[model samples]
Target: MEVYYSKSAKDALREMTCKLIEVMRAESDNIPFNLALSGGNTARQLFALWQEEYRLLIDWNRIRFYWVDERCVSPEHEDSNFKQAYENLFGPLGIPQTRIYRIRGEEDPSKEANRYSELIDQQLPKKNDLPHFDAIILGIGTDGHTASIFSSCHFLLNDIQIYAVSKHPDTGQLRITLTGPVILNDTPLLIPVIGEDKRKILERLLEARTATEDFPAACIVYRAASAFVFTDITI
Candidate 1:
């Protein structure tokens, strides 16, 4: 796990974007870059920047898009992560239809998770019976949740596949989230976080020597090939 402190949310987003551009430019492997994107305000900023100007720095066709997690909502819904990314980034850049693999959030939760698992099998490069993503971008909540895995309950953390269905304990909303073990075994992981509210959990996550079920975000850093964190919060 590595931590980078940005002076503000804007600076954090800038740093995160710069890191992504660096990755794309430096990549020499022939396989398409598999990116699992998270949703949040900072992500929205990143998406907008890429769509408006920065995305031209890399080969768009060689980059494929996936979601780290998605709320159970229509693609057109205001709360939909895919909608935010599409409106801000994917659509504007005319990303090819075949390259975008989104979770069917509007469908039944368990079935959609299974479908996404199949999609991962079909789209991503396989290693040791699991699909490995090139990058998985994430965001953490104040309550210490990453993706839909919350601190309030014991989630099914032992799944062997790429994605799983977890319900938000409070809202009861279904979420399709990439599993912990799969994330730990994948490529570089980026967590760009912001706001004063995030400071405490960020510190704890940074200090974690072992991943715990209580703090799901720590699972991302557990045995991960490389982990980079960009944050605006003070620890």
Candidate 2:
């Protein structure tokens, strides 16, 4: 694991984008670069930044976008992760639909999870019998959840499936998320944890050297193939 510190959220995100571009560029252009993305207010900020300044820096054509998780709602729903990316990043970049593999959130949660899991298994490259994404970008919730693996749903940390259905600990809202096994595959995990609100949680996560039940984010930090954290919080 490695950490990059920034003075502000925008600066952290700027550095994150540059790092992503660097990773994408290192890949062979003949093949598609698979990237998994998370959705949240922080992601919205990153998308906006991409639309404004980094659009030209990335080879949008070679990029295949996938979601790390999605709310169990219609794609057009206000809470839909795909909707957030489409409106902010895809629309502005004119990324083709052929390259976008979104989880059908409106469908039955179990069925959607199975469908998406299969889709990824068939589309992405495989290493050690698991689909290998070039990179997986995720955001951390203040509660220490990452990719919908909340404290209440810690079982997902060992779920054997590539994707699984998860319920929000408080609201019981259904979500489809990449399971721990797949998430910890031979792929880079990129995280941008910004804002003063995250400092304490980040500190706690940093202090813990191994996966703990209380802080799900610590699992990724300790077990991922490689993890890079970009943050603005001064800690």
Candidate 3:
């Protein structure tokens, strides 16, 4: 794991976008570059940056978008992760709809998990039986959650399947998230955990070299082939 500190959140996101473009350009060729994205207010900020900066410059046809996790709700729902990404990024890119493999949050959670699992099996390239994504970008919550993997949901860290369902620890809302064994592959992982609000969480995590299930982000940092953390938080 390696960390890069930006003077501010905007600067960190700017660097993140540059790295994302480079990854897409380098990885996209024979097939659509499989990219999975996490959802949050931070992601919204990044997507807005992408739209304003590189929306027209890149060949978006070479990329396929996937969500790291989604709340169980209609895509039109205000809380839906797909809605967030689509409104901010995917909609602006004008990529083919076929290339967007979003988990159906409106469908039965179990069925959607199976469907997404099948889609992963059929769409992405496999490395030693696990799907290989070109890039998997995620964010960290102050409470140490990443995607839908909360404190008590330690099983998600080792879930080898493509996707699985979890109940939010606080809300009990069903969620479909990419399993760690599938997303934490050999591909370069881009984790942008911005904002001054994350300082305490970053301190606790950095002080502990171990990946505890208590803080799910630790698992990602530990399992990824190489992880790059772009952040504004200073410790």
- What TM-score against the true fold does each predicted structure earn? 0.91, 0.98, 0.95
Q: Across residues 78-196, which tens digit of lDDT does each residue of candidate 3 receive?
A: 99988998999888877678888888999999999999899888888999778888888988888888878888787988886788998888879999988778767788889898777
TM-score attained by model 3: 0.95
Q: Estimate, for each residue in 1-235, the C-alpha lDDT of model 2 and write its tens digit.
A: 8899998889999988888888888889899999999999999999998999987788888889999999999988999999999999999899889999999999999998999999999999999899999999989998899999998888898899999999998898999999888888878889999888888889988999897866779987788878999999887
Give the winner by TM-score: 1 or 2. Answer: 2
- Please provide, for model 1 over 1-235, each residue's C-alpha lDDT reduced to its tens digit, 9 standing for 90 to 100: 7778888877887787778778876776676988999997878887876776676676788888999899999999988999998888888888877888888899998899999988888877777677888778978887778877777643656666567888888888888888876776657788887877777887788788887887777865665778888988877
lDDT, residue 173, model 3: 90
Clashes of 3: 0
RMSD of each: 1.9, 0.9, 1.4
What CA RMSD would candidate 1 show? Answer: 1.9
A best-first ranking of the candidates according to their lDDT comes to 2, 3, 1
